[model samples]
Target chain A: MNAITIEGIEKSYGKTVQALKGITLNIPQGEFFGLLGPNGAGKTTLISAIVGLVKPNAGEIRVMGCDIRKNPTEAKKYIGLSPQDININNYMPIGKIMEFQGGFYGVSVKESRRRAEELLKYFKLWDKRKAGRYQLSGGMQRRLMIARALMGKPKILILDEPTAGIDVELRHELWTFLKQLKEKGITILLTTHYIEEAERLCEKIGIIHQGKIIACESPLKLIEQHRLHEKAERSGAFQFVRSGSLEEVFVALTGRPIEEASKKSGEEKWEALPASLL
Target chain B: MGSTTRLAALVQMEFFRFWRLLRQTIVPPVLNTLLFILIFGFSLGSRIKEIHGFPFIVYIIPGLTAMGVMNNAFSNTSTSLHMAKFDRSLDNLLAAPLKPFEMVLALVTGGIARGLLIAILTLAVALPLLKQPLFSFWLTLYFVVMQSVFFGCWGIIGALRAKTWDNLATTQTFVITPLAYLAGVFYSVTILPPPWREISLFNPLFYMVDGTRYGVLGVHDAPLWISAGMITGLAILLFAVCVWLFQIGYKMVR
Candidate 1:
């Protein structure tokens, strides 16, 4: 059975700019799924709709057989979302932040404290539990967000650009931690700009472009089946390479430069376009 | 999470933040109220005789109490909600499983708590300075609570609608502050000339102040029951509007 099912999801801002245009996806339980897209390709909108942050114009979303719109409390119980930015209560102590987050998810105070302690220690934050958010280093703050997301022990974890701005060493450390969750059989839906990160962490990948799913398959199959690999091989552009990487496949499918895909202005640019293009 | 647990968690976080900055959140309003009593109640009262069968100092106690409650309650929610938007911490609540009404209730609870705390602090100061004892403690308490809830809802609306800090400041400067002062805080409406006296009745805070004054001094400008009914009706109307705004995610989630 699927852990999350999104059918005919549509969202718009006013009469212009349809953010998500009839998106449909099904992520099976225990699978590691990656969603790759350009800046304005509705990745965040889809995630927001699932969490009930933005009400979609039309769609049906279910998590573990509970409809997100009809039974949000039950549906939300199965999922945890670690958004791109980490904005917590800055004045509170780190220990209190985790404890309250646990309580927000309905854990008893004693149980929440226990989980907070366990997660903090696991993230190497136990020593700094008394410190406020301003006292922590950037790397530690990012790690703290993931620790907080895991406090509820959710069945499905959704991470949006978790490693976007971190240094290489810390990024690898986070990758190792996330690997353990996959080992424990927690389903993960990750959205990322880093092709290599998705290739290394995800079992299956879906590429969205202009509010539509352009491709969905395993990394190996996607690379082999893409036309770029055949053309590159025939034209001797990558003569010594054994096979095209996921990055090459992504660029081929989206037909846009990686730099252009990563720009923050892309969202605004899309919004400024006419509805016909949107 | 159960709705009850989630609501408890939200309110707990708000209280924790409030207590963490007790000096900033609780002290200024208390100090301001004391200063007003010293200048207007004592310094000014020494020259002026009794206006409403009570000394000028005693006549203004309920007005000052209502002012403190209304201002503090309004600030608590407005500042917190505005900061939540600026810092994007509201994302935390939005992503949670809480219903819109629960979220509104949690925020309103924080505002009312802060307002009541300020009211109590000011009342403590007033007890020693008043010329006569308060007439009915329960009635005074009721007006204080109602004022807090009413202004708390207004605060939510201000925070939700304000797109800039200047916009918020303009509202306080041009709207709320003027209405608060004109609500018979310093002098009785009986002293105002014809149309002005009639206009004072339109300001909701007038009813709040008059109701509490009747409770505190056993003298009031309007009938106690009419004042009570007006404030109660306004509070309920504001509360219903806030609930509707929250449910629709007005100027918030979208």
Candidate 2:
């Protein structure tokens, strides 16, 4: 069964700003899927739509073969989300937050407690388990959010920029933990600004820009395809030249210069990877 | 089976969330009501004498109790929603297998629980200071529960409309505060002239306070059934609106 399937999904904020535009993709069960895009490429919008947070103007989404619109509760049972903003209540203990999240997913108190203990330790937050949200550093809080998401034992996990503000060491540690989760056959869908992360972790990547999918392929295959096309265009004259990096390929496909794409905005842009790539 | 179980789970989570923030969730309102009783019930009761054939302190207790229930109910849902919005924790909930009705029920019930707890706590603290038992125990309990549910729905309405912390503050200041004070917490409607008394009848909160006071003191400015019917009708109306908002994924989840 497909873990997630999107068909002609469309969303617009207010009347003018089209956040998502007729996006369609299918994620196989247990696949590590990466939604890659520059800022304002509608990555979060697509993720939010699939998670049922934002209503789509048109189209359908199916999770584990259950239509999200018609069977939202059933679809949601299999999904867990760790949003981009790590905003938990600072007044509450970390353990309590975890318990609350677990309960929301129908976990019994005893089960929630056990899961919290295990996840807190796995995330290296056991020592700070009793601390209020304010006591943890930024990275620790992000980790705690991830742990909270995992508390329900969801079959599908969506992480939106999980390592955005974390340090290098912690980022590496999180990636390792994520890999372990993937190995257990949990279907993971992640949106990240870090190209290297998508390169390393994603088995299949979909580069989105301006609410459209520009490319959907294995990372290595995408890079190899672009290399072959470039070589063919040059007619063997520049065969000795080093192949272009993913960053270069991304820019070439999307048409937004890398420098301009990296600039921060109030809302992260995830527009279709420039139409040029397709 | 799916809906009921998920609803129950959401309610359980809601309570857990409130328990975690007990200091903010449960404490302040009880303390505030206690102080109101001490200052108004004791200090002012000395001067005001009796307002409705009962000591001033006893007369105001039911109103104050209703106020406490309303305030807690409002704060509980409003703050929870705001925090969810700010921390993005709501997204996790939105992604879950729960329906919008389930979420609304969880939040509204959680608010009611806190409201009930604060009402009980305040009553417990006020008991020692009372000159006598204020009203029939069963009627008082009914009014308190109804008032809590009513205002809890109001809180969800406010939270759904609020986009920022300041917006919530504005709701409390402009909406809840006016409703509480104007609901006749301090004085009887019999003392008011014709036009104002008629206007007071329009304020739904007044019925909540009056019905609750009638329940407690057995003396009421409005007929008991009238007040009860009004409150019940208003609660149903507000609940419908809240449920609709939840179904559409209105401001709360989006």
Runs of candidate 2 exceeding 4 Å displacement = A232-245, A256-260, A264-278, B1-28, B38-49, B128-131
Q: In candidate 1, which residue ranges exceed 4 Å CA deviation?
A: A14-16, A227-242, A256-260, A263-278, B131-133
| lDDT, candidate 1, B74-116, per-residue tens | 8888877887887777777777666777777887889889988
Window of ten residues with lowest summed lDDT in model 2 chain A = A233-242
**Model 2, span A1-278: residue lDDT tens:** 89999999999988878888999999998999999887777998898888888889899999999888788888888988888877676566887778777777778777878999999998999999889888998889899889988987989999999998899999998899899999999999999878889989999989887789988999888887677556454433233333565554566576543335656432243344455357
lDDT of 2 at A44: 88
The DockQ scores of all candidates, in the order shown, are 0.55, 0.54
RMSD of model 2 against the true structure: 4.7
